[model samples]
Target chain A: MTLLTIVLLAVITFTTRYLFLHPSLPVKLGPKMVSFLNFSAPAVLTAIWVPIIFVHEGELNVNPLNPFVLSATIAVIISAKTKNIYWTVGVSLAVFVAMKFFL
Target chain B: MLTKKQATIKMIQKGIIDMLPLNLAVIPWGILCGSLAIQRDFTVLEALLMPMIVFAGAAQLVATELIAENAPLLTILFTVFIISSRHFLYGLALRQKLKVLPLKKRVALGFVLTDELFALSTDKKSLKGKLRLTYGVSAGFSFYFSWLFFNIVGIVAGAYLPDLTTLGLDFAIAVTFIALVIPTITSLPVLVAVCVSGVLSVVLKLMGWELDLVIASLVGMYSGYLTLRFTNQNQLNEPEK
Candidate 1:
């Protein structure tokens, strides 16, 4: 079953990727659909990350002192200001480590 | 003859330049995955294969983590399915740009349609017609090689590496999104859409929705869509502005 999971994951991912490559792969998209999918990039991401940040084991981590949360907020501000991934991650991770040490 | 080869090289360089900004974050995530796969008792072969096969850092991370927790196979499958559905939207956005390419090239390109590639390819308007396509292909394949090489690096070091997560690399993924979003977030509408989506995501979580992530995203998307539609209708009612 473990082997099957790995193999199935590989095949399925490759297929989705292949669908993107195959020009004749008729994208079932109409105008309305295209417009809707436009937001999928961010929308889908939000679905995955929000839970990780807010609820851990079904409890809100409202303690504004969590390293990861503080790091992410600082990261967002840095990213918004500079739009650079390297700096944003660098600053956030550094700040997080500092926070861990200090408080 | 020189112009032909030079043009191809130009396209490739443009593709690389476009991708470099995003790759900074992507690289660490790949490294973290490679390192973690080893920590979780994945053999060298499995460590190497996970990124190559799954081809997504986040999904693969989630999948491996779930597998470690003794989750049901069906649950793992469903989780991957949910995460991968993001590709459908990427496909939608690239439709017109890719409409004219032959199937063979499209398939080749599809294998590397990552968020990095998508972000790079979409923002580029320099290469028009045939030249544009060559540019796109170069971008996709460059990412492919980078991914392959990074996975091997991860697999090789899997045994000796400390906790990749403890190293605080996961934050890189979220930072990557912020980096990508900033460029496209120039307009008021786009700003509103992102804030609404992000805030609603937190709100939905507070409301105790188990699938708040998916629901919050849907709320953000719908809000953006309807706002656009309303603005368009109002414009139509008036003369061209």
Candidate 2:
């Protein structure tokens, strides 16, 4: 089962990973597609984050007092502001631990 | 001095460097997967080899669930097929980007074309044409190797990893997902797509549609795309009036 799982999934992932640009496939996915693909990244980000960043454990845990929430928010802002992913990640870790343990 | 060969080798090295962030995301996932596989009765060798061969987290999860349930082999095969539908889209996307490559290289690249590497490599406008062959292969191999390493780490640690959920490794996927989306949210149609995707996912979950996760994902992507096209056409027609 393990080997089967790995081989099958790897095959699928690899195929699609590079599937976008295959020739002779009638990729009528012209100008709008490029734009749509452009939009997908951030929109998908929102779809994933809003659920967690705004809510937690399936509840609305929106409060500055929530360390996990706070840390993540700070991290997002820092990431956006500085575009420094390393600091954003590091700061978030520190904030999450500090706020969760101490606060 | 073989300087160019060394430079070519750097291609793979560059892949490793770029994938560091991706590797962090892969760790807990690998660990969680490893632990789960063990609980389901996979031998150590089986557990370790799976991630090496398949290397995809979600597909592995779905496959494990099916196996544990003792679903018929056909049912297991179907589930695997459904879970793998994303790769078709992935392949479609890469088709034009890679046609110039010889068949063997394309097939080989296809082998290592996981989600992380594909998303990262395609966006490099600097890597158009056959040049992408080198870059993509390098990146693909790096991610594949990284996955193998961390997966082994996770499988070994799976015995010791208690309440793996508490480790909050999920956030790695969340963070990576967020990072993936940050580049795409520039328009209302796209925003609508995200909302649609989320609402559909939640609704499907509520409706007890166990397999709807990826289905909802496709719903979200294509619907959002059509909506964007519709609105654009409406705007164009409005000018003629």
Candidate achieving the largest TM-score = 1
| lDDT of each residue in A13-73, candidate 1, tens digit only | 7665555544566556677666665666665554455455555555577576787677777
Candidate 2 residue-wise lDDT, A1-103, digit = tens: 5466556555555555546545555666666555445444443344444555554555555687676567767766766676655666667766776665775
- True-structure lDDT of candidate 1: 0.69
CA deviation > 4 Å runs, candidate 2: A1-71, A97-103, B1-7, B122-127, B163-166, B183-200, B210-241
Off by over 4 Å in 1: A18-28, A42-66, A82-90, A100-103, B68-71, B124-128, B203-214, B235-241
At residue A36, give the lDDT of candidate 2. Answer: 49
What's model 2's overall lDDT? 0.63
Candidate 1: Cα lDDT at B172:
58
Clashes of each: 4, 28
TM-score of chain A of each: 0.73, 0.73
Question: What's the C-alpha lDDT at position A41 in model 1?
Answer: 61
CAPRI-style class, candidate 2: acceptable
Residue B234, candidate 1: C-alpha displacement in angstroms: 3.6
Instruction: List per-prediction Cα lDDT, in the order shown.
Output: 0.69, 0.63
TM-score of each: 0.81, 0.76
